[model samples]
Target: MFNQAESFPTLQVLLYQGLKKITVVEMLKTIGQDIGPSTRWTIRQDLARHSVKTLTSANAKEITAEGVIIDREGNEILIRGNTVVIATGTRAVNDLYERLKERVPEIFLIGDAKAPRKALEAVAEGLAVGRTV
Candidate 1:
């Protein structure tokens, strides 16, 4: 079991078998959720069944032909894979919003394009916008 207690506020990812499955777990002590031993054991068993390799506390430094180069507690670990999926949260790129703002006087921007946040926030924003409209 790879403990990611050192890196907080960063996402720790586990890629299984050449991009067959990707599991993203947040490594923030303040915001992290605790998983019981049984749950962890079950997860391990499932991964083992599917031949999924788990890399813990891995901070991706770069992507290379070998796979993703990660920094784990100062030691570099390379995860070999044919496919790599990088899930970097949401971003607010309001190119369309800016363009439409001139043509449409009243416009509401919702979701990640407006602000990169949780689905709950986006859903709340959507409901608020819907009520206004």
Candidate 2:
């Protein structure tokens, strides 16, 4: 986001530039990193994925399939049915917003967008320029 005044002038100019000779799919593909969704949204399920139920605590970092804690402190580690495991990647700055957007809906992001290159120092410079300009 830019300052209140600078935020929309460029966007307004682009919007008023008259319709381009591009198809909707072409435009969405260009804007959405060249990959569009293959199918429409559906209230559907694929049965190949299995589902299991278990009560999980915030501290239950990892566990085995048979409802067993792989390494944790619990005196009542006694009885239970099958468990479930989900895999996720380590956190990186950009993708965290993509994943957690629903949890925090009012969101905004900005930086050296059209700049030719991306790097740690370049990102820092972009943020600094964003703050000032």
Candidate 3:
């Protein structure tokens, strides 16, 4: 989304999570994983260049006829837009693949089914698979 934000004239990302520096031990204990520092840096740079407004510690509270209301640290903010996108994080799921792999002679898993990452990575994989087909 950060990379594609340039296509939208106005885009705002409201994240309910807080941005803070934490110890490695705290991170591993709480989240059990971390987004690599280099990837974070690249995303930050892309967001900065693309003019993607980010509201950290903000969440969507309600959607009324007026617009979408947000709670940013207890302050109510009304944002009026044609579209509202609620983005949850991505995770890999291979339940169907597991069930069908043995039954099907040839089955190729691409994109999120293989591993959840950026869209470009998935697209590249899809193109490669399409060529084989």
Candidate 4:
């Protein structure tokens, strides 16, 4: 009964209609054009196909997202790598990282399990960790 392709647009429209005020804050300076050449093309194409508009370099404060507070500024944005990947799961187990580090010379911990954070932080950490691994 729930088709993602059909439901996503309906959900977006509902959010727009239901919310009296809505602001989009994109931490990334460039949307869909800075990941990499190929990825840039894909993102650009997808955005165009979906008619999604994005605002870049927007600073937000006092934000309650998914029941968590987010504080961000333009200067505080971290862009160490040229790619984006999402890794989602339960909170990171401290013992897992420590135990793995003991058994393996190269071990890196990432995402909310390492510390509860937004998807953006997790993605950033994953990218940083992936480069080392």
Candidate 5:
């Protein structure tokens, strides 16, 4: 969505998040490179460069007839938009392995299949699986 926003000539992109800084889980660094630190700065700079407006410490409380009501620092802020995109994060479901394990001879649980993670970790797992295969 961030990449797509750049193509719009007159579009106003607003990103609202509950957290002040976007960060990756600390445990991710133990397996691979230290990408956690760079993510915050990189995202901040990229968003600014692309003219994307961001509201930190702001969470959507409700959607009324007027606009989206955001709770920011104990204050209510109304955000009006033609379109609303909600990104609530992701959860990993490893149930497939349980059901297929009885039928399948070989099973390789990798990436999100093992647990929820970033693209870098997913790609690393994919590469490792490919090499093993």
Candidate 6:
């Protein structure tokens, strides 16, 4: 996801975040591995730093990539590439087995989410089916 840059050990070049350089480790952690070297580093940095507040306008304008955009009064305009990925996942699809379940008669469900829990279950089910006939 990052563009290439000055690399180090155990890092993947993913995406470019504005002027700020982002690392692979940072990328994964941000997504949600929730664990890495900087995990400790972030904690240490947070402990070392102090918080403060800044004022802003009532309605903040949304920034976009296209068109010439600038900060404040179009002072020193910083051009940064921000990639936005929209993931609208639509996987409400059914499988062949599900279709069969809709048409078939005397459908028996078993273990692991309707799967056999143990080998014995399969054997017992087979035996019961056999006895039924």
Those runs of model 4 whose alpha carbons end farther than 4 Å from true positions after fitting are: 1-24, 64-95, 99-133
Best by lDDT: 1
lDDT (tens digit, per residue) of candidate 6 on 1-133 = 7767556532322221223332111112122223357676665444233221111111123346642233333343433336423322233233555768879776554332345245666677777777775
CA lDDT of every candidate: 0.66, 0.37, 0.62, 0.55, 0.63, 0.39
For model 3, the local distance difference test gives: 0.62
Work out the TM-score per prediction.
Answer: 0.54, 0.19, 0.42, 0.34, 0.55, 0.23
lDDT of 4: 0.55
**Rank by lDDT, descending?**
1, 5, 3, 4, 6, 2
The TM-score measured for candidate 2 stands at: 0.19
Model 1 bad stretches (over 4 Å): 1-51, 118-120
Clashing pairs in 2: none
Model 5, C-alpha of 89: deviation from truth (Å)? 1.2
TM-score-best of 1 and 6: 1
Residue 39 in candidate 5, Cα distance off native in Å: 5.8
Model 2, span 1-133: residue lDDT tens: 7566645766665554444221111112122232235522121111111111223322333355555332123433422335333432223355655666688846444333333233664677767767775
Error of 4 at 25 (Å): 2.8
- Please estimate how well model 1 matches the true structure, expressed as its whole-model Cα lDDT: 0.66
Tens-digit per-residue lDDT, 45-106, candidate 1: 66665565555555778889977777767887776766778864556998999889989869
Off by over 4 Å in 5: 1-36, 39-42, 102-106, 127-133
Candidate 3 runs further than 4 Å off: 1-34, 90-133
**Residue 87 in model 5: lDDT:** 58
| Ranking of predictions according to TM-score | 5, 1, 3, 4, 6, 2
Per-model root-mean-square deviation over C-alphas: 12.5, 24.1, 12.9, 12.6, 10.6, 14.3
User: Which wins on lDDT, candidate 2 or candidate 6?
Assistant: 6
1-133 per-residue lDDT for model 4 (tens digits): 7555657778776654553322334656766433668668876665654555444655443323232122355344332223233222346567877767878767777787688767898899989878776
Identify the candidate with maximal TM-score.
5
